[model samples]
Target: MKSMTSRAMRAIVTVSLGAISTAAFAQADYPTRPIKLIVPFTAGGGVDTVARIVGEELKGVLGQSIVVENLPGASGMRGAETAVRAEPDGYTLLLSSAGEAAVNPHLFKNIKYDPSRDLAPISLVVKVPNVLVVNAASGMNSLDDLIAFTKSNADKASFSSSGVGNPQHLAGELLNRMASVKLTHVPYRGAAQQVTDVLGNNVTATFASYLAVASFVEAGQVKALAVTSSERIPSLPSVPAMAEHPQLKGYDVTNWFGLFAPAGTPGPVVDKLNKAVVQVLSNPVTAKKLADLGSYPSPKQPEEFKSFLATESEKFKNIITTADIKAQ
Candidate 1:
């Protein structure tokens, strides 16, 4: 009986060590198989575009084929959850946006995975800020003027956004809180009508990407008030950042993209992935492509990206709670 028990214990230890050694050898080789890059959006969308472009470049760097798969649903949470549950073998990766990784858990009640816990951060791919624009007819020129208008004419001062829980909606709510003003939110199905209403003076203002309403802005049909980034962007250098105002200091928001793998993936695997991404993002042609879409390629290592995600999660939670943002 004693010999049998001792044999059982040794067998268990040997099996455990074998498994660990196998995993370690697998991690050392890394992408021995084709990698599945999941983009939680429809094809041709911004997130999908990022996935494809970056994946194409990463294939060369990693010497493996990258297959970009779209898994769009549940405002991107479905795909994020899928990636979170994937085997942590570095073969499955998620190209996530702010919506899925930062805001969805706070916005949706039934989120299956906690982004900070389930998704291991590799790098932040890009940052795209929205321009807060008002109808030229409204005569609200700067952030100060807009604040004053919303305070005095709260009923009339309103901002249109694509959806209820999107970044645009949160940006408006942030202004309401920090500036102590109430600009009524007008949610739309998409940004096209939102921009149209702003131009028609049916709505006072809307937060849109500069590229989305660049023609109107250039044509003087819409007035640019401020950008939602921490500092003014070079594309619209003359406009001030939202954080520049005394009342709304530290106000910054943007649609950012990042790369993540499932939690429990080996540290060495994550490090190798990050190195490939850093090299890929520096490609001149790839940088140019992202730049044309108003995206700045910004890469950070695992630790730094982990910190950014934490800060962003906290900030998003505050905005959603204070503004009572909900998903439908």
Candidate 2:
């Protein structure tokens, strides 16, 4: 009886090994069909823009079509949940921003998926700085003027964010904490609406992704005061870094976009996807296109991105905890 039991266990082990080998082989030839890249934001937002840019370039390298599906809602939770529920076959990739992977998990109490547990970090695509902008006619030319205005007209001074718990919202909170101002946060459904309100002067200001606000600033529709980065971006060379101000001495917030797949995806498949992403990002045309949109290619290996996500997760957690941030 003991001999029979041992034989059964050995047979099970052999079958398991065979299955693992087969799956690895399958992953080696990944994306037999069109891969779906999910963007967890509305169309024309920074996330969607990055998805389309990378998706188009990725197809050339991977030799498969990439379908960018926008599933914007729930402070980016709905799309994340959808991606998490997808099969771990490497075909369902998610283009997630800092808020979805780092900020929202801590801010939302009833979040359906934990990014660290439910998603596999594929690559860090780009890091775009958030800009502080106001309507060109707001007559608030500099960060100082805006601060003074907010301080004096506390009730009327408002800042718009794509939504609560978004990196833009946190940047606003950081500014409030660091500058000792009381600008109210007005969360909008998407950057489009927020930009519209800010451009119309219906909102006092907005801390939004540089990509979302770049055209407006270029067209003189909005005036950019400062960027939420330690250094000024090349695209907006004249804009000063928020950290340069005495009031916001240590302020630094950048909105980063990265790729993720559902957890448990085969390592071989993840490696292939990462390789393809690296190739696409290294292309000069792709880099130029990204730069034109106020974003620069910032790719990282799968393991590096995983580690970076862990670091960002902790960083945002500290920010959320210190700011007492909550989703509305």
Q: Number of the top candidate by lDDT?
A: 1
Q: Write model 2 residue lDDT over 100-155, tens digit each, in one string.
A: 89988898889999999999999999988888999998888999999999999998
Candidate 2 regions exceeding 4 Å error are 1-14
In TM-score terms, candidate 2 sits at: 0.89
Candidate 1 error regions (>4 Å): 1-18
Per-model TM against the reference: 0.92, 0.89
Weakest ten-residue segment in model 2 by summed lDDT: 23-32
Clashes of 1: 0
Backbone N/Cα/C clashes per model? 0, 0
- Candidate number achieving the greatest TM-score relative to the actual structure: 1
- In model 2, state the lDDT of residue 114: 90
- Cα lDDT of candidate 1 equals 0.90
Backbone collision tally, model 2: 0
lDDT on C-alpha atoms for all candidate structures: 0.90, 0.89
Which pairs in model 2 have colliding backbones?
Answer: none
